[model samples]
Each structure stands twice: as structure tokens, then as C-alpha cells.
Target: MRNKLILSVASLAAAVSLTACGASTTGSTSSAASSAASGEVAVVKVGANPVPHAKVLEYIDENLAKDAGIDLEITEFDDYQTPNIALSEGSIDANYYMHEPFFNDQVKTKGYKFEHGAGVHIEPYAAFSESYKTAEEIPEGATIAITNDPGNQPRALKMLETAGLLQNIEDDSAALTLTDEQNPKKLKFEENQPEILVQVAKDPKVDLAIINGNYILQAGMSTKDAVIVESTEDNPYANFLAWRTGEQTDATKKLDELLHSDEVKKFIEETWPNGDVIPAA
Candidate 1:
């Protein structure tokens, strides 16, 4: 009888060990189910210029993304070329620095398989000066600085034309190039990258500098202080978000929606109240 009692006790201990293992397994499965039911947040990585593009994204990330069931990871890019390159290489899921013209040019020249959403905002191209307050104050044969990129050169030239600095421009297309005759003022054109145009503007020798609107904000320069500011009416240069073809997910669509929402428009208006950045219609 004692021997029988010993075997029964051993069997009871084995049953207890098995019961504990089963409970652990059941608890782990329950936890996994709970997680699956809650769903994971989608992450959308974006590359953008610092001033307004990233700033706008930052606003959306901080205020709107969580409710949309997604998260934004923004990578700031200072130059124009790298953002598109990063998008092409899958380093970033999307980019938001280029206007439609620039975006078209990139796809045409580099053959990037990219697609874009509607215009988000317009950073009006403006001309600035350290030596002169008005466009007319610029002297004849003045050395005016402009961007060297073909995509944006037309815009700078167009602004110059609006200032009556350039004339006889027959070809108004994106392929337009400034000729000696088009420059009626005999103004000398100094072509540089867009980012450095602000520094060129500060230079005493450079008579005028036509800078991008985003750069103006980045440099703490106000559009109200510009000698010439592009009109926002029917402007075609509104910047938008871009992504590789067929790579856009639901999260990216949600981001694009947030960018155009009324709340975003209010944020932009309040942030740059002087019209430095205008929400695209």
C-alpha cells in the first residue's frame, strides 16, 4: 500500500508540471491574439526639404498621423537632387520637395518611375537684393543671380521678365533658355545652385538674387521684404508629394489626404501669415 501511494504522488507531481506548461502556452497564444486584433500602425518614410516641406510633414506627424493609423518618418534633404535619388533607390517611400515642373523634368531626364499627388502648397519664387529695395532700383548691366538647373531657370527668367528686366522671349515653354537678346537690360546672369542663391543675395556685389520661396523661409528672409514676389493666382509651381510607381500604399494615401486637409491649410496660413507659403487650391 505504501508503494502504491508513492507512485500516485509521483504521477500527481508530473500532472502538475504538465498543467503549468499548458497554462504558459495558453497565455502566450492569448497575448498574440490580442496583438493581432489591435493591428499594427503603418509607417511611411518621406524625404523633404527642411523649411516648409518637412515642417508641414512634422505638423501632420505630430497632430494627425496617429488618428489615421499611420506614422511618419521624415528625412530632411537640403539639396534638390538627393531626395528623388533616395526615393528611386527605396531609401525613402516618398518625397515632397519638387514642383510639378521639376518633377516632370526629373522623370524625363533620369527616367525615374515615379508618380505624384496633387499640389500641396506653392512657394512663390521671389527676387531679393541687398543693394536695392525695388526691382527698378537694380542698375543696368547688373549681375543677377539665378539657378543653373534647367527645370527652374525658366521660372527665374520669367520673374525677371515680369520685372521688365528681360524681353523678346518667344519660347515660353519649359525648355526656354535665356538669350543675349532676351536680356534687354544687358544684365549679366550668374547661374548657381538654388540653395546658395540666398548667400549670393547677401553678397554686396550681387545686384539681385531670385530665390525659391522655401529657401527664403529657411534663411529667415521674409517674402514681404522681397523686391519681386510671384503672384499666387493660377500659379503652376505648387510643390507636392511624389513616390515610386506602384509603391504607394494606403499609408501614403492617408498622408497625401492629410496634407490637403483644412487643418493643414490653417496651419500653413498661421505659420507663414505673410504668404511665404500658400496652400494649393
Candidate 2:
């Protein structure tokens, strides 16, 4: 495992430095003009996953944030845990990678007061395989891979349950962390972290694996390759711009506008049609 300590510091420093530069560049001129015309400057720190989330924010930086008189500095995380830690410690002002249930879990474990800022896009989970061309083609008895992290495990398991390969444990609301669950396919399950789940998908021993949208994009797989992908409309976990509790109203508002601006919405639509990444909106 990588050292969380070093990454945290680097993330903190990167966020602070960029926003500071943005503020110094236009702080006075914007203040003197009308709120929009004056080019007022606000500095904000945000954490995100590497592919689409960070990439989406960078798109905002280019089109929306710069014009709105806000300077956003972003820090990227590969795993899910560290960004919330950075936000709780005051290292970053906000984070944009997770949904509500996951964020709630973070607060419970890490002991921080955090709140959802703005609803961003949804990243549907996808099921992929190397041995089989499609989900239905996989033989009855095959090995499947899932994320090892507690947070992702349940989600993957739930997808399998929905696919009818596994019978979920009765009454488990958080069905992702299934143990002793009946596997009808007699499928062998291997647990790996979310980021590495794709590698497992590539293995010949692996028949199918559940992976998130961003990882699918990272692996250069298209929707055609996915045997299953999360439905955008009913997915419970809509990614949000999360901030330290009480701070959700101010810079967060601007961040929200920037994220959901007309241009960002259009980009998501055109770039990922079929409602693959539906805006919370």
C-alpha cells in the first residue's frame, strides 16, 4: 500500500497553491466590479478520482470556473478512503468522487462533520469479462472477481445478486458485503481493490467482474463490452461534491454552479449519451 501521509501532504499543498494563485491574480479586480463583472476570487480545494471525476473538474476549470471568478485546486486519489480524510483534516475544502451512502460511511469511520454540496454525475457500475464474450455466454461454473474494499464489495455483490447469479442474504440492506451467500454459478470469488479489479477482469481465470464506470473508461472498454452496467435513473449512489459540514453553502454553491452549468451538462450528454452519466440536476 502507498503511504497515505505523503499523498495527503502533496494533495494539500497542490490544492492550496493553485487556489492561492487564482485568488491573487483576480481578487481585487473582481471585488470592485459587479459580483460577476468584478471577477471576484474565491479559492477552493477539492479531491477526486483520477479519470472522469478529475477530468470532469478540469473541464469545469477550463469552461466554467475560470469565468465564474473561482479558482479550484484539485487533488486526486486512486482509492476511496483518503480524500475524505484530507477534507476532515482541513487539507482540502471539498471532494467530488463519492455518493451519499459512501460519504456517510466515511463520516462514521473517520469522525468528521461533512455534508453533500452538489449532485454531480452518476457513474454506473459495470460487469466485464475476458473469457466470455457476454454475460450470458459465461459457463455456469465460472470464477468472478470483485473489489476487496468493504465499501465496494457489497455493491459488486449486489450487482451479481441482481444478475441472478447469487442469492443475497435475506434482510441485509448493505448487501455488498456478502459472506456465506449462496453462489448458484459455483463461481470462485476473488477480492481485490476497486482500482485493480480491472486487472482481474483481464485474467483468463476470471469469467466476469464488476467494475465502476471510470475504471471501464480507463481500461478503454466501451458500453458494448459491458455485460451489465448500472442503470442511471435508479442508482442510489449519486456522486456529490462533499464539503466540511457548515461550509456547504458558500464556495460550495459556486462549485455547484460550475459543476452543473449548462456547458458541463451538455458535455456529459454528448460525451456519454444513453444517460450513462445522468446529471443529478
TM-score of each: 0.83, 0.79
Model 2 per-residue lDDT at 249? 38
Poorly placed runs, candidate 1 (over 4 Å): 1-39, 170-177
Model 1 lDDT per residue over 151-222, tens place? 787877777787887875542422234566777677887888788898989888899999988889989998
Q: Taking the tens digit of each residue's C-alpha lDDT, what string does model 2 give over 1-281?
A: 01122233335555444334431222222232234434455656677776678878888877777667776676677657667766765656678888776777677766879888556788788888766666567677677777665555666666767777777534333333445446666667776667777788778788888887777776766656688766666667778788777755345578777787788878887877765566775
Each prediction's whole-model lDDT (CA): 0.76, 0.66
Clash totals in order: 0, 6
| lDDT value for model 1 | 0.76
Candidate 1 similarity to native, TM-score: 0.83
Give candidate 2 regions above 4 Å deviation: 1-39, 169-182, 274-276
